[model samples]
Structure formats: structure tokens, C-alpha cells
Target: MVVQDRRGGGTVAVAMACGTGLAVGLLTSGCSPDGAAADDQEPAGRAAPAAAEVRDSADALVRAGSAAVRTSMETASGGTRVAIRGTGGYDFATSTGRLRVVLPDPAGRPSGGHQPITEILAPGALFMKNRGAGVPADKWVRVATASLADGNLVTGGATDPLAAAELLRGAREVTYQGEEWLDGVRVRHYRGTTDIGAAAAAASPRTAPALAAAGDGFTTGEVPFDAYLDEAGRLRKVRQWFRFANGAPKGASVTSTTELSGFGTKVAVQLPDERDIYAGKIASPTP
Candidate 1:
């Protein structure tokens, strides 16, 4: 019972707008429809905090995470394979920013089939199926824009990086919760609440309909995260869990995994290079 967040819906729009340009690892079928990248784990025994506090924390966390993400659009792998790693810079607008393919279909490899159109989302890049069944090695499509940036000029999403950041900045209260061990790291966790009324006002008079909707805020959406805060109160590693506006049930949770947090760090942005774009040197669809 996962309530797909506006992100999933936004992800689809990205696939449509890019018209199948970049991205990989977007399993159109297997992945959650609402866009919860992975399984939705239910949190336990947590008191609700004031909306203002949570929004402020989220913004602080996003800011601290600036240039901390190993930003890339990659494939799901469980074996020894080389997948195309499309790298990019974070706009922190919370909306997917500029993502370039650092590795295209490796030299003399057919990767079109496995590469589908994806929205270079924050935290990681997402590829949604548009042309082929799943991602095959033969259907890989490259960018043909005059910008020759080898990336899509993406624009869409109920919540953009800037908007999301703003809401997070206004975060008010924080309810101490539990914790989880990811990749062998034990992290502190908590859920922060938000004030939809205030959020809507922050959206401003002429905010885009979509951005406003996200900013217009919800009656109650949970901002769950593991606070790895800096000395200055900036978050270092944040695992964000977003639920429906009213704490209905399970929705989508995007975990922001990172090791550093700061502004103006040496972040990498490039187009997909063939050699580093798919299953261990670009695995061809099984014959």
C-alpha cells in the first residue's frame, strides 16, 4: 500500500519530456508505481513534531548535502557487470538538475536496449522505459541537442530543488525516533512535521502550478531522516522518508546517501561514456 508521491508522477513526465534521451535502471514494471525506489520500511513509535521545525531541518540537510552526492544515473546490478554511470551536478532544487553521461555505450558495445529515458533525479538518476521492454543493450538512445551538452534540459516536477530546499529550511520541530544500519553504518533517525498552511504561503503568488502544489504543502507529510549533522547544524547524511500529507500509510522514501556536505565542492558533471554505461562493460541482452 505505497502512496506514490508526486515524484513518481514527475518521473513519468520526465521520461515523456526528454522523449527518451538519457537514463538507465528505471524498471517500468518491477519498481514501485509511486516511485519509492526501494521497499518502504515502516517506522515505529515516533511522536509528531511541529511542521515548521522539520521543514527547516530538511532545508539545512539539503544545503549540507550540497555537492555531497555521488550523483549519477545507474543500473541495478547483482553481478559482475559494468553499467553506464551518467554523472551530474545537484541543483538542490530537489528537482533533478543537469546530468551528463560520463560513460556512453562502451566502445563497440550495443547498449541502446538496456538504456531507457530517465529523469536525472536528485540522490540518483532514474531511467524509465519508453522504447524497449526493460533496458536492453540495443535500444540505447543518445542526446542530439544543439547544446551538445549530451544531456536533457530537464524541467518538471511538483517539487523542484529550490522549493524543496525552502520547505526544508523552514523546518520547525524534530521528534527523536529510531535508527537503521545501512551498508554497515548505524545512523540516528527521526521524523519532522510540516505546516501546509505556512508552506502554501511560502510558495509565493505566482509559483508554478506544480511547484506550488508541493509547496502549497500537505495537511501532513512526514520528513523522516537520519541526522548526521555538522557542527554548524548542517546535515551530513540524510535518509529522507516522505509520507502522505496526513500520515495515511506508506508512500515513497528517497534516501540521500552522502559522505560530505558543503557548498562549492569539486562536483563532477559529464555525459555518459560508452565504457562506463552498462552491466560490466555493457552486457548484451541474453541471446
Candidate 2:
């Protein structure tokens, strides 16, 4: 496995860990409200804005800043499904955050996928556990964000609110879908389509190369997305659909839906026990 940082740092190929069937690429990289109101005169106190005010505001919500979010997504390649669900927080102000990945098996089946993986991010370092198979259980691998190749993090089960929002920033068409309730809040729903290449670039430029490498000749045409936002203009939910015109790398399409809540919440991350961390890299496995 080769680990690089976000900057142009040097790359290092180390033993690849197969914990929970996690791909090497993943190691790296890695909505809204509702409304109502009556017509005719004004209805009592301040009623929520009308349907017209629920227009697409993805860009505003994305650029508004960072917040804590709960994420769940699944990627299908060929006929197998890889599901990753976790709770993490991103601070848009600093463009940094942490996530705890609950790994599942290769087929996302009930058996064989329980390895523990945790990622911590600061300004330049991304510290993670179980970089590869056979590595000491007590050690955390550290990789420089600057040195990582493009798109490496993106394919690595990383879910960032700011990055996800970036995909919506360049939407080709954003239309009001209607109203829906999520987590007990009524939110306005909006749908749109955006160029996958451009959206990936905007979300995280570093992941572009990795995405290309992973998809190689695969075509990711316009990606359709649905977003739900509340009256406060905060994002509540986002659903994305990606399909390849020529054909998906896995012979099927991929869809991921992320739900957000507890805006302006604080996410606390603690480093794992130092006694369990191994500073040396594991050797590459024999062919």
C-alpha cells in the first residue's frame, strides 16, 4: 500500500492490511427543513416561509461553514456491496475533521467484517489504525495529507460535509422538489444534477487521481442529487445517485445518501492508547 499526503510529500509503499476487506485506496481519503403557512391574511406569529423560499440553496449551505453529521453510504462494484456507516464531524473553518469507520465484510454480509478502523486528522497528518493486515493491533499508521495522491481519500470511505457540499456547488440544474420530514423536522427538498468530474474536483482535488485510477475507463456522467434543507438554511439530508454511461467499473451503479443533523455541534476525538501504537511500517506481503 502506498500512502501519500495532500501536499506533494513523498510516497511510501508499505504492507497492505486487509482488515475487514478494506481497499488500500480507502485508507487514504478518506440538509434541511420544512415549512408551511396559510394564505389570505398573515397566520398568527411568524409562520415558516412559503414553498417559493425553499429554492435550492446547496451552495449557501455548503459555504455557510462546518457542522457535525452522521453518515452512512454503500458502494456497489460488480455484484458485491461494500457498506460503510459512521459518525464524525467536520470543521469547515479549518477544513479538517475525524471519523470512526465501522467496517463491514467484502459483500457487506453479516460475517467476516468486524475489524476496527479509526481516522484522526489535523493540519497535515492523518493517523489511522490497522493500516494493513498482520500489523500490530496496538499501532496507528500516520500518513501526511499533503503527500497523498489525488482521489485517494475520496475512495477511502471518507465523508465530508464540506466536500459533499462542494459537489452541489457546481450543480448544472437545481430545482425545488417539495417538502419532506426528516428527524421530526419539516424540510424543503431540492434536486439537481452536476458533472461528476467537476464535483469530485471541487469536493477534494486530492482524490481526483485516485478516482480516475479506480474507475479508469469507467464513465461517471451527470450525477443526480437530492438535498433537504430547513428554514434556517441548514442542510438536513442529501441523496446522490451515480451511474456510468459506458458501464460502471463493477457493472452496476452506486448510490449514497447522507443525513445531517445537530448543526453547530461539537465532535470530540481522542487519540488511541499510545502503548498500542507501533511506529514502524509493516513489510509488504509475499506474492
lDDT of each: 0.33, 0.50
Question: What C-alpha lDDT, on a 0 to 100 scale, does residue 194 get in candidate 2?
Answer: 60
Across residues 1-287, which tens digit of lDDT does each residue of candidate 1 receive? Answer: 00111322222101212333332222222211123223223245424332333445445544544443332222211211222333334544343344333333323132432342333443223332222324354333332321211112111111223334443443445544445553454544434533333444564332223333443232234343334433343433443323222222332222222333334454443444555333322323221
Q: What is the lDDT of residue 86 in candidate 1?
A: 32
TM-score for every candidate vs. truth? Answer: 0.38, 0.61
> Candidate 2, residues 1-287: lDDT per residue as tens digits?
33222222323221233222233222111011123311233124535432222223444554556566666555443333445665677665555667776655433442244554676654444566754555666577665543443222333345445555555645665566566788899987676666646555544443333333323322455556777888776778776654432222333334556667666666565655667666664565433
Regions more than 4 Å wrong, model 2: 1-66, 77-82, 106-113, 121-126, 142-154, 197-218, 243-252, 269-287
Instruction: Quote the positional error of residue 235 for candidate 1 in Å.
Output: 2.9
Native-referenced Cα lDDT, model 2: 0.50
